[model samples]
Target: MKFVDEASIKVEAGDGGNGCVSFRRERAIPFGGPDGGDGGDGGSVFAVADPNLNTLADFRFTRVFRAQRGDNGSGANCRGASGHDVDIPMPLGSMLFDIATSEKIGELTRSGQRIKIAQGGFHGLGNVRFKSSTNRAPRRASPGSPGEQRELRVELSLMADVGLLGLPNAGKSTLLAAVSAARPKIADYPFTTLYPQPGVVAVGPFKSFVMVDVPGLIEGAAEGAGLGIRFLKHLSRTRLLLHLVDLMPPDQAPLAQQIRTIQDELRAFSSEVAQREQWLVFNKCDLIPADEIEAVVAAVLGDLDWHGRHFVISAVTRAGCEALCAQAMRWIESQAPRSEQDLMDDEISAAAAAAPDAEAGDEDHRPA
Candidate 1:
């Protein structure tokens, strides 16, 4: 999948069938009335949410969508066949906006959800309908009305319970692989993960939540210094953010400033993202000497002025990963279920919203 999140398309409804005009003729009848048939109704156009889809990249290939046209009516009081309704399949979290009116017309968050994009044209009338008391013989029939047509813009935002945030090579991929079945690319280089990868982390039997791993952030990322601008929107839908910090950074990196760099970027990008509930997680503890681990942790905390919830884990060894995931599951269980309306509030990505960022993250990272 190319992972395209936005697309635009044109849709048109089917046209109605035309009416028939004819008069009944019989050898035995002295006078016969009109017996024209009515025309069939046109088909409407609709957009449906499909659970199997995850991106709007497919929309790039086909843009125009038209419904089936109705069959024309015939004489002898025969009605024409109605047009078939056209239904388009799209991924969940995708929203449709009207181009001309700039209106938020429809949003598809749940599977099997459908919304009408255009209405089919009305069927035409027949000459029999024009017969009146004053005018005994009618020779006129109405034409079918044209179907509705319009252009629309579609935007997709992936929804998740938890979002992982950190600098590049922050062990995001390793942690996701440890906690779930997702297999993200793991390398020692920065910017190894280019996009967001989601996985289901099971806390217990039948208890789990979706976790999205976004690309790493570097200094000045909010200013488009790195790939952060492209993927920052992925965090907006998350209820909680897990900030992973590398304990044993290469070249003896500054522990305190490492956390602050990510923080600064997030705040600069969006206030909502900066203000979210973020839990500081010290990663790669296995790399630190067992004897000096306590002192190093204490020093890192002092540098960060840490007072909030914190955790120490090693993704490579799977140490403390289970406990961390368990706690996350419990936290999600305690919080209220998020409403679909919340997804519309984020403006982090190309789409504007009131929530956090718009579309992406890979928090399981920062190389050891």
Candidate 2:
């Protein structure tokens, strides 16, 4: 049940059965012709997305997967039994890649979705197939073909409607815990939440949106600082981003500069992600002096050249949290239903296109 987001594995398809070479021998017939049957085809390897799964921990222990080999052909023109296929179950939002070629195989975004990772070998031909008028009672038979083998990298990204972005201890976990059933580890210290946590935020009856709390981002996060570039790719699928800023930080690095630092990191990560719809959220309002709250908000807005929607809330007290959730739900509901598969495909294609550059140490942040 441990949360494992990434894993590597090798898969091998089943080998086809060998063909039989035989001729009929009957008392009534003087000369018998070739009557051997063809061999059975090998089994294939497939990966299936299951909604019940939320992690890739299952792949951690088992790194090698191989399908069953087909049975050998029998005498008297009897075909061999086909091999059983191997199915690997993974969580929804799993992305598969070819490690050697760096090719994007596919992404699983919906329940029951499946993709063939390796193809089975073809069955061998029997002597009966080689029999003809030119050569009667042929004794020729073809050997079975070998199955396909591949080394793959599997990574999981949690699917959500809204993503929380901010520096460490910006109250993202508290917000998620307050609004939904997800119970993330909470502490006053930074980096308390190491992994992504998902929750269902309900707006009304039959109206809800998923929210994801990603790990904290440091100033040089795009350059592999802090938690490194491991979890940033999870933000690509989010429709809206909530940029949380601590209004009153004990460290006293100008609040405006802190906001800018996060913005710079976002821009450095990906321009496409930077241009996504983002709302400025000033958190920890309760700690801010009553008279200085407005001044601080105005100063931060001016520093960022603000002309967009913003909010001020305290995640611990649940102050303004409801409104924030409401607004998030409204924005999510307004946007078109972006196909999860299409988005994942785009990400994979982008990664594949940048593989060469990545190999050359191109400082590009890609999902591991």
Candidate 3:
């Protein structure tokens, strides 16, 4: 439960309740005028989403929240009590930014949703609401309204449909622990999967998808280098991008220059993630050498000049891992009805037909 994904918090919202004044008298009634009362309407923070939360680590160490302060008016008119709203929860995707003008302010991503943010404070006004007739001993009242702080930040991401990419120990946690149910933390060394890690796989009888693994990405990972650019916003909601590679590399370079240095750090982190729809696998292949498996898969696909689809699996002896998980569930059921900008234009035309000669730069790995 030490995942975290990101946080910041502050919130606050709930502070209106203060308007009594009083003035009724008794013993039959001496002049009974403005009975005052009227104040109570504060308490709103919200946030929700909670699919049993995945982890923001409970906002780290409880980063201030607030909400609940109304109640305060009773005199003979009575009318207070309305605060209790806080909510918060989070998890299912999160996002909500705003920490001083970063704006965005929304994005729970389903699982109950909710939102609000902070806005509760407006309930003051008593003295029988300024009863008049030339001011009948009024004496006004009002004094409450003040709740709506903020700061926020959140930022989870994780939603998936496949998005492994590679570089360090390019086995993507042994192909998401050999096809889903996620256990992660496999190690042969090299950044043994640090964060992200979702799973779900299945492909029939109620078909499934979600994949994500994320973590290992180097060569100036989108600019902050190793584990930076915060796991590239969990691969911008992924849609497909396996990538892997390591066609046998104890680091003797040349698996086509380590697949062109992970396709030049994924087009230097974001040419729409180097034009998604990746797919290329070729993982451990049982560490190559079975009579040089067809000459190391034909010299690593002719020096990484790769063409289109490619597989070779081995995620720890599941060789050809079920036809690379049945051809990645048939290209995620044929791009599950496209649109994510046509699956990022079919992953930048399959990364320009698998690195046509590389170089499709322009940078902007998103997530400023």
Compared with the true structure, what per-residue lDDT tens digits does model 2 show for residues 1-368?
55688999999999998888999999999788888888888999999999888999878789999998887776678888888999999999999999999999999987899899999988887898898899998888887898999999999988889999888888889989989999999977655468999999988999899999999898888999988768888888788999988887768899888888888988888899889999999899999687988888998788779888899999899999999999888887778676999799999999999988777775455456
Q: Which candidate number maximizes lDDT? A: 2
Candidate 1 per-residue lDDT, tens place, 202-235, comes to 8888999999998889998899886747778778
Cα RMSD (Å) per model? Answer: 13.9, 13.8, 17.8
The weakest ten consecutive residues by lDDT in model 1 span 354-363
TM-score of 1: 0.79
Residue 20 error, candidate 2, Å: 1.4
lDDT-based ranking:
2, 1, 3
* lDDT tens per residue, model 3, 1-368: 65788889898999999888889998898889988899899999989898987888877779998999998897898989889998988888888888898998889888988999899999887899988899987987998899899888888988887788777887888788887788988755566577888888886688778888877776667778777668777887887787887776667777667667777877776678677778677787676577876677778788767787888778887778777777878877876666689779989999888774443342344344
Candidates 2 and 3: which is better by lDDT?
2
Clashes of each: 28, 0, 1
lDDT of each: 0.86, 0.88, 0.81
Least accurate stretch of 10 residues (summed lDDT) in model 2? 359-368
Worst 10 residues of 3 by lDDT: 357-366
**Each candidate's TM vs. the true structure?**
0.79, 0.89, 0.42
